[model samples]
Target: MKKILTILMIVIMSTALFACTTQSNNEIKQDLVVGLEAAYAPFNWTVTSISDYSYPISNQPGSHVDGYDVQMSKELARIMDRNLTIKAIEWDGLIPALNSGEIDVIIAGMSPTSERKLQINFSDEYYRSEIVMVVKRNSVYENATRLIDFSGSKVVAQRGTLYDDLIDQIDNVVHQTPLDAYSNLVAAVTTNVSDAFVAELPVAESVVKSNPSLAIVKLEQGYGFESEESDITVSVGMRKSDTDLLNEINSALSQISVEVRNQMMTEAVLRNNESELTLFGLITKYLSLFVQGVGVTLLLAITGTFGGFIFSLVLVFGKTQKIDKKRDNIFKKIIKRISNGLSTAYIVLFRGTPMIVQAMIFYYGVKLITDISWWTPLSAGLIIVILNTSAYIAEILRGSMNAIDKGQMEAARSLGFSRIKSLLYIVYPQAIKNALPAIGNEFIVNLKDTAVLSVIGVLDLFNATRQVVGATYDTVTPFIITALIYLFLTGVTSIAVNYLENHKAGKELKDA
Candidate 1:
């Protein structure tokens, strides 16, 4: 057991070391690190083909990203005499990534809204697009020419975006909670979760073309969203401190006329449309990625759950320690009190907070304090899972220990065993038998929750599916594949737990 644990630890540490050893912000002065949501079509999207206009996404092997933003970034890199490196970041995480020095700029069709301007600087607009509504093909809003025509309809948009804010413009519209991705928005509209969703013209066109059941409603000029220049114009985002770099980027963008920008968008749309594949074709083509993602997801789940169980054992033991008032010394008493307090506090802190927030704090916070290459996304994710899972397992263990008959400990003590020995040899084994089911359930939960780690770029099952969606523009089938994989994992775990419980019961009957 000790040897096995040591090997696991070594494997985890080695993976962390390799994952974190990427080029830091300061080391990439000659390289332009551009961040964008590669899932968005026309503006940016992931592709497997390596073409003259495509660049490989950082850290994603065998995957390349090609879109209008990518082409523009390439031209900007050429003009600035720097190599362009693209990173496919989630939309909500793009600004934070730039601010945290993870990427040099955001070219993901982001606008220079006032809210975003306060955190980072922006270059001149590269692409201008009008807002449009995407609705069901035969829905009432499909033929509506103005925003007021859909006054009572339920509308939604991607969260933290200018489009989300624009949803309230309709006089009596039902504004649904914003989702995180355009693919999600597409799902919402197609499933009738919302009557319509706000989108840019090109984005709406891309989605509508792929999904024949969907259609676009182009509002008349005066009836559209009332907006400012910042809302409609997409620009490159940079850190506020990089004024010189920002100025150079703006100069490069200025040299490219509006006609050239339009030509690039046209080319990107043509390419994106040409590469579109059927849902079944996409699943079959990307089966290898899905399999790889399963391996990663299982690795994280097993290591995290096992590590948490080990740590929680120590914590439960510490919290359940008995202090003898007459026999224990002052130092012993002090240590006991401190350990109990710390155990309780740790349990509360981790269990009370969300895992996603913890992931962000660890990933970006460590980067701010230290430039250590060993703090990779996988390592951070594992740490979060261990810490978070430890708290729940501690509570579960405590309950299981309490449920064990007190007479068992007393009986063992009378048989020439010390209290510690009684607890470890006699009490712990039964407690573990009772707790095994809960531990297995925790493993299942970890399998699903690890999907949240994709925000920090851990390529688990969900992230792999997102990459497929980005490449194929088919949202439904990739997600269906991911769901089926999760179901299989949890189902297997459940069956294993049940088998162990039944086997243990049968052995106890034989002993009796």
Candidate 2:
């Protein structure tokens, strides 16, 4: 009970931290991997493919990723004469990677909150954004100029963000549930799950632009929670230990004029209109969103894979022990049935549905069952992972069970043993011998699957990489390191599983 409550509390607190940010998978590797959520248009967003839109990137290699951060990172790479590599990670995970010595810089649009300062260091503020409200033009909130106007109005912010906290300050403002993706928060407002979304000005403008039916109301600077240019000022994230690198970046940033920075911001906002344009325009426009979404993409694969193994366990029965038939029947028919069925149910659901849909269902769907609020994302994520994994592992079990040979079960049955007793004593032990290799593979997949939890906001490794991008503004170093760490973990798990399989198989052969 204590453990469950603690887990529940952690999950609830996590929701309070969601935020609106840019993301993209639209770009994976530049010379420098600048991580950012590119979904925010004007700043970043995913569009189709394009040519003739070269600013700083030499490689648009096909069409998946490009954006404002890409353009800026490319320019920064140009200034420094370094190759650019873009790694897209989630909004929250970026920083822990930076502090842990994974990424070299965070270029994603991020606020240098005082809390973040304790983990790693930041660069000089690069750009400043404002706070605003986004709502349905027909909603009562359409005329809301200050947060105070929304007393008792339903409000929702991106979970795990500063805005989520900011939205909580309004008197009786009725803070509604948070969402998985910051980009999706607008949908909540448009759908009336929330009256309006509190966000940075760039986000509001881009959202309002992409969606004309929406209202973008800027509250009087003091009336709404407005951070100063210093507060909204975003910076490059770097390690304090690398004073030399920090010095170099600050020098580079100082050289760029405010006018150029403003123009960059403006171009980012303008690019948000790409969806209505020609194919080329669309490509040039949302390339950034594509790039930033990489974190979530990688996350999906990693979590799906790891989640498969955590829930499956090998069970064995022994025939030589002269076990009682009644007890064996209870184990197989009752306990085993329930446990196996549960594991099976999870797998069928996860494998049956798309992971993205699962992620959405996790964040939004589960809320109807509880008011604890925080369990919404965490439970949804684990359940999806658990389910996805069970499907693959169940097949592994069935195959291994078949490999044990029917003769063993019959041999045990011939000796006064009941059907359940015979199978437990005869068939199960050997099945474990056969299934070892497949189960190991599942673990490797699960290790990677840990990344998927980032979507609903578990700050696992990939998400850590994303936060790094936001904090540092530099990109190439973080992703390479992040990938290497994942590789090392998978490699280690593979070896351990192999050793166990070899040990158990050798024992099995000796007994035979």
The numbered model that scores best in lDDT is 1
Q: Global lDDT for candidate 2?
A: 0.60
Best by TM-score: 1
Give TM per candidate.
0.89, 0.56
Query: TM-score for model 2?
Result: 0.56
Residue 476 in candidate 1, Cα distance off native in Å: 2.8
Candidate 1 per-residue lDDT, tens place, 1-512, comes to 99999999999999887766654533555989999887788888877657898888775555678899999999889888787888877777788778888889999999899999999999999999988899999988889998899999999998898898988889998999998888888888889999999989888877877788899899999989999988989999999999999899988988899999999998888787734566677767777778767887998999999999989988898888778799799998999999899999999999998999988888888877776767767788888899999999999989999998899987897888987798789888888889999999999999999999889877788888887776555678888888988999999999999999999999999999
Q: In model 2, where do residues sit more than 4 Å from their true spots?
A: 1-31, 52-64, 100-102, 226-229, 275-407, 410-512
The lDDT values for all models are: 0.86, 0.60
Error of 2 at 374 (Å): 35
